[model samples]
Target: MNIVETQNLKKFFQSKKGTVKAVNGVSLNVIKGETLGIVGESGCGKTTLGRTILKLIKPTSGNIFFDEKHLFDLKLNPRKAKDILDNDGIDPKLRKSFEKNKYGLSADASVSKKGPNSWRIDDDRSTYLVKGEENSMKVYSVKDITDIDDKEMRKHRKKMNIVFQDPVSALNPQMTVYDHLNRPLVIHNMVSSEDEKLRKMVDILNTMGLKAEHLIRYPHELSGGQKQRVCIARALCLEPDFLVLDEPTSALDVSVQSKILKLLDRAKDKFDVSYMFISHNINLVRAISDRLGVMYLGKLVEIGETSDVFQNPKHPYTKGLFKSVPQPDPDKRVKAPLTGEVPSPVNPPKGCAFSPRCPHSKAVCERENPDLIEAYGRKIACHIFGKENF
Candidate 1:
């Protein structure tokens, strides 16, 4: 079963001149215990897409489903739902609801409630948006989060968590590692006593090769690698089913990055968590990700098994990225580097977002955008490759 799925997800920020299309329209899923890596150049919405999936960035439109439940819907938080209904402005209310959802909204997953990152339905039949066969699709309207109440959103957040790109900023200088990691335990009611929390905390840290002594230290006291380990430890404290790891190892030394990567390897089984891993480091992503999605100018132009994407990229942009990955051997093919400035997100062109920079862009690529279509057991969003109208 898919742990998280977003359909036609879009998030745009308004500015004085116009809107900034940070995340245009993205559709993807993180299947159970799988790593879905998103790669793109800086400001191609990799971070924005991760944040939107975590609902930290309120989506302009689209449906986000968590473990098959319509996230932030009225059933999840009736009070927040009523509030949105009262306001009558769909966008702002859903956005506002998400802001409070992590604190204490209606998060409703019950395990026995037990085990690491695994949940057991207390009843034979859990609630569903539509009354039909198990795991069947419901009407899309029910998936909208606009009607959810703010107070109830938190109930849903414990199952999903994020470890951000910059561990220094993500951690609080004032708080000790214990303070940082303890909050999620408190929020999720994972432990009844402080000692239990401490035991679990120490165990988690130990798994990351950290000792109990480090728990008392502040974020500023730790090295870059240790800080990231602490960040990962904090995310694991919740035993989240889905984790959005946004460039978790980018800020460390090469050796340190390897250690952190090893920690992540151990974590997948220890936590049994699915991941939406976002990174700009293509090589690292290729090594770690089960599936890879290539993004260009705020759209996912290619997606498939990591090996397939690296070996047989269909889109021109995807090819450019593969070529750019540092090859250890001699540089034989000396084509000029893929060159062109990324277009302004505030005023993107009318056609394919990657057209301006594409080497094989045709008149159609400059006129109408292409839909993502299936090709070679993967998906490609290029007019030239899609099996559709030219």
Candidate 2:
């Protein structure tokens, strides 16, 4: 089952230059108990996409469903359902039927609950409803959380958490290690008392190779790796099902990086959490991820099983990324590096975002953006591998 899913999710920013399309219609999924590695050049919307899905920054548009339930689906038209509600009067029998199946509105069918994210109707044309089984039953595979208010969103926060790339900045200077891990537990009421919170923090810290004594030290007192461990510990304290690991080891040394990677691997099994590991380290991604996604200019150009993608990448952009990975041998020459400056997200290229830099670019690549299509047992967004060419 998919723990997290995004459909045509977009996030744009307005600057003096223009609207920056940080994430442009990217759709992907994080499977339950699997690591989905997302790799791309800097500023390709990797971090932005992670934050957007976590609702740290509200997306401009699109749907985000967590654990089959939408973060918010507030596009329901009250007027459209008004007639049905008025005429049928939300018969007690029908209301029970809706509740029994966990479909339709909660409580009174005509009235919505306190939050804006509530599903308020059951109709054919409504965006909130997902009719299934020949439209016989209004089945909502999961709740839509698109426009939920902050208060309601907080309730779901514990289920998902993020660990930033730079641990130094992610942690507060004044806050001690214990404080960092305890805050979420307290806010979510995961623990009953101070001693219980300390015990819980110690247990999580131990898993990260830290001791109870380190909990009293502030961020400044900890080394680079220690700080990251604390950051991971804080995220794990919530016992989240999903974690957006935004380059968790990039800031650490090579030796420390391996240790942290091992820690993350152990944590995955110990805590039963899924990770969306975002990084520029292709080797690390290949080592840890079950699946790989390559992004370019704010969109995924390719995605597939890690080994298959590494052995044979379909998208030109993905191929360039693999060629760029440095070999340990000094004599091994790097293949043709991708040329041409990356296009501005504010005014991206008309057709394919990578067309300007692709070696085998054609007139079609310059005029029409290709959608991700299934080919060669993987998803590729290139005219060369598109259905028409095949």
Indicate which candidate wins on lDDT: 2
Q: Give the true-structure RMSD of model 2.
A: 6.7
lDDT of candidate 1 over 288-353, digit per residue (tens): 999999988788899889998888888888888777666556765535667787888999988998
RMSD of each: 10.4, 6.7
- The TM-score between candidate 2 and the true structure equals 0.84
* Per-residue lDDT over 1-390 for candidate 2, one digit per residue giving the tens place of the 0 to 100 score: 578877778999999999999999887878889999999988899999999999999999977877754323222244433333345345455455455655554543442321122233434323333222221323345444567899989989999999999999999998998789878998999998888888899999999999999989999999999999999999999999999999999999999999999999999999999999999999999999999999988899998899999998878889888888897789987878777777889999989999888888899999999987777777788987655356
- What's model 1's lDDT at 6? 69
lDDT against the true structure, each candidate: 0.76, 0.81
Weakest 10 consecutive residues of candidate 2 by summed lDDT: 111-120
Q: How many residue pairs clash in each candidate?
A: 17, 12
Best model number under TM-score: 2
lDDT of 1: 0.76
Can you tell me which runs of candidate 2 are displaced by over 4 Å?
Answer: 69-140
